[model samples]
Target: MHFLSTYQRIISRLLLVSSLIVTGAMADEVIMPPAVANTASNNVPTVGPSRPKNIIIMIGDGMGPAYTTAYRYYKDNPDTEEIEQTVFDRLLVGMASTYPASVSGYVTDSAASATALSTGVKSYNGAIAVDTEKRPLTTLMEKAKALGLSTGVAVTSQVNHATPAAFLAHNESRSNYIDIAEAYLTSDADVILGGGQQYFTPTLLEQFSAKGYQHISEFSELASVTTPKVLGLFADVQLPWAINDKQAHKLSHMTQKALDLLSQNEQGFVLLVEGSLIDWAGHSNDIATAMGEMDEFASAIEVVEQFVRQSKDTLMVVTADHNTGGLSVGAHDKYEWHPEVLHKVKASPDVIATRAIAEDNWQPLTATLLGFTPNEAQYSQLQSARMQGNEPLSIALRKLIDIQSNTGWTSGGHTAMDVQVFAEGPGARLFSGHQDNIDIAIKMFSLLPQSVQTP
Candidate 1:
């Protein structure tokens, strides 16, 4: 264990050195795979070209470097020796530090990090778009709306979730669901998508409708929302896990639809698209569900990548608010992490456990959902957990998968780890190298017209 820790430290130092060199070398240009580089427009300059007309901020909630690295391994083709680069790998230009205000400690909740990313100001944990004093801070979305450019949010979680809420509203606490939901009523954002139908009442729905926003509850209803203004709530609180959900690329679909609507404005738009549930999965230490969410998020990034490439006047920045779960690729002093075992997982552990608890023929049901029969020891663990309750059974299932995959997690909460940042299109070069979370929002503010920027 001592030797392994030493080796890991050495590798981390080497990675840091390599990162510095790559960042310095690519400061003036967007570095992508040869295939992607060839297709990029020559007109897209790193700097000096006028600011991008459109800006797309994609936040993968709780996605740290570990998550991306794990995704690479999980998605790798075993048939080939060389690992394939994901959309994240291709666009990754730099990294960012995620720390909230000093009052809240180094680790940040989704709300504080999102506040910093949206308002260019550090705020205490649980703060929405408010600073430590609970005062309102002008968010990027508000600025875009004031500039007469379209603004919107599209996320897999409720629109009022911490990340999206910070961009759209000002509140002292992220838990103020009613207040945040009501704040959305007054926001001029053209597109609002996600869940949280429980927070909105009949009167609030009528108010949104009166404000010219087309409100819909079903995912299928997205097509009928042709107007620039639309409110989509797909679930009562948050969407289902991607592993068990029928809509495999829900985030990608929502992002595409958002772009379609926001692009109608001649002045361009500023859109916030969040893979919100990646955090939730991470909190549960659910690797199978985490990979599924990452895949959906990656697909969404590809959609935006294509849009930015085609438009040439747009900037797309992808990052995470903070790290969650302290996820490690390998666990239990094992040198190997088998991502193949996770690929066969048909449903989340919770769902599998719930069904197993309800069904009489539980063994086959569990095996089918897990895509593998448990060994004698694992079977005993499952049986023991089954007697306890659904939650324990779920934990046991996760443990079995972790034992097979060799995955490790240190916490069920946020960590003080830096997150990777991926960018492309005009003004993208500005984000190269390491930066504080607030710096990300400040840099984006520079991309906006000077007239509307706060002094």
Candidate 2:
């Protein structure tokens, strides 16, 4: 429990620091205990060179300052317009950098960025966690296992997607789902969680009873498993977001279970958690959806905090690969129906999925929740799209914005600008400067005991 007490003190320190800063007070530090916080006086310690016993990298896909700020604002102020300290603000470290391999006035896709962070080397866009020749490189996960430590990867994305796939599977192309699935079977990562169940299921949808690998498809089935090498593919693909929940799979549940199973190994572990839908909502330019995704991630962070604050040697690096959609909070409230009307809509954003339930029902649903009288012209457009079996949340959101406020920018793609990184733990001091995505691997290994270092 020594580690637990130290971690709790660190979290409390962070909370105290943030609360102070939010109140317009500036303090040099919140003063955590010697074991929990990294002070300049204790840069080089006797704790095996500040190596971490456990590591967690949380990725908020396509989440940059704009998206993060908007979420923080709404979360801190759901009422008046007073935003609180950002999650980054409470971290021991913060920095930013680009996602691409070079500065050619270009932007990067998820694949290149994922490879860069996983392999400690940058590659062209669309490449998996491999170099130009397609040669497989050792990732942080692979290295951790090589040193007799356990590793795990969890995300809200399909397990075969670029981000999660980077940690385990290595191939020339990130789009090769079949190849990625094959790689997962041989990875050293002990606890694999999240979607892409169909990739392994043959035409007959076989179970672990018929395979060389252990597998589970339902949350209950997952919670009941006890095997060392377990893969919980909870959905055929990306599980529905919390708002929809048609599939009823819980992302936080999967993450918690992975942490519990991996932490039992005394050799230590490294885990990755991602809220992949933040990017999806960004692509659709939908604030309501993005806000909900952020809320879900916030809850997940709370879960990690409980465990993180218990382990003195664990480190948490929460970051985003890149920014999407140039999103900005509206500068003015264009809707004039009255504060009470807007309050109702904000209070029950759940009315959205209810809007999505039927053929032509979404129009009235959005109109009602938006505090606007139903407009025949707009309803006609929505009805036509629904008649053609299309449900572009973007259209409804655009209409909502048109009625409520002026949307400042537009996009469905990544920004050339850099993304932020936030770190918490003993040696988090290694994270303060602007850095390449590739440095993440090197810095982490530097924090680990020499026995755990890869050649």
Candidate 3:
């Protein structure tokens, strides 16, 4: 009897592994409708097209550990009205390292990390795309522009925020909003989209106009400008979230529209699309807002996927700069699954006053507070401290507690945790195993022709 029981347990373990492998591979198959076929020209040099005609880099600015896991629950849950497609799904591979040059630490601010990702070098936090001496660093966009390629940047946050500004702005300080706005004029980035119109007032507006940039403030005006070069800024700062700002317009619409206009140049173009608020959601500890941001981020990914499918030469890279909130997951099983938990996570306004909260470790307090608490199976473990006590920040978040059913966090912060990177196209195969964040810039630049290697 003992022998038979041991044999059965071994079989169960193998079957579970097999199931996971199959599910993972199957989920990785993200089919882009045929519209993506011509994203890069098929007929190319025998040596291969040295440069992609179009490059779309999608960044989830504040998406750290907590955000990733929380969204996974939403996607895995069949009860939701909208299906979530995380950019990670497209990843043929992954990595967990996002360290800066100065040292190894748990939390590296977005400004420093983004600067490294954008310019291929690291600097202290709060520095834009500049080196330690406060000198400007030439970014990939600058290199592309030097080679006559067009460029554009789009974000859901203030255009000059740490993530988006890192691509084009080179300032001693990332906080120099006014100067960062002015730098856009010199970028030669033919296309510029997103908010922060407030930065481009009459004085700055005149500068762009003088440089011969066709600038517009409204979506309708965008169509009329009809210039080979276009610069569109819709809001004074970051555009409103799709949920909170539906009265405004859609992010995917802006992304698709930017691609439409930028693709006009046969010389090729590079565009950066960011879902900045996923990070904000982590900071606020607002689960619903975070899910909303993930859905929006997915729409932007669909746009890139569509583009990638059309163009064989185009390499679409989707990744987060770092993981925020140390996001993690509960062990998956029948014991923790609950549909009512989804609506339960709302963060406290006090979160802003402080960056870390130990009690919000992701277990669905909503389930506990609602009296649905864990089943007898889970309670046995909790009683032993395998799980912590249930603690909900507020009634809003409490409702979601039952759904997530997870708990464990050192603090509310970005982990030195390695972020995931997904790539698809001709040279995408080069991405595998672990690599430095700066390696992304190096690998991408290597594919460019010699003349553009240094710009």
lDDT (0 to 1) per candidate: 0.86, 0.66, 0.62
Q: Each prediction's TM-score against the native?
A: 0.89, 0.79, 0.71
Against the true structure, candidate 1 reaches a TM-score of 0.89
Worst 10 residues of 1 by lDDT: 1-10
| Per-residue C-alpha lDDT of model 1 across residues 1-455, encoded as one tens digit per residue | 11233234334433333233234433353333222334445554432434688999999999999999999999999999999999989999899999888788889999999998998778899999997789898899898888878999999888898999999999999999999999998888999998899999999999999998899998888977777899999999988888987465778888999999999988889999999989999999999999999999999999999999899889999999999999999989889999999999999999999999999889988999898899888888899999999999999999899888999999999999999999998767767888777768876765676454432
Candidate 3 per-residue lDDT over residues 210-230, each given as its tens digit:
888777788667656555566
Question: Which is the leading candidate under lDDT?
Answer: 1
RMSD of 3: 13.4
TM-score of 3: 0.71
Query: Candidate 3's C-alpha lDDT?
Result: 0.62
User: Per-residue lDDT tens digits of candidate 2, residues 217-331?
Assistant: 7767877866566777877887766655523436677778888888888888889888888888777676656666777776676677667778877888887888888876664
If ranked by lDDT, best first, what sequence of candidates would result?
A: 1, 2, 3
Give the CA lDDT, 0 to 100, for residue 68 in model 2: 69
Model 1 misplaced regions, further than 4 Å: 1-49, 452-455
Candidate number that wins on TM-score, 1 or 3: 1
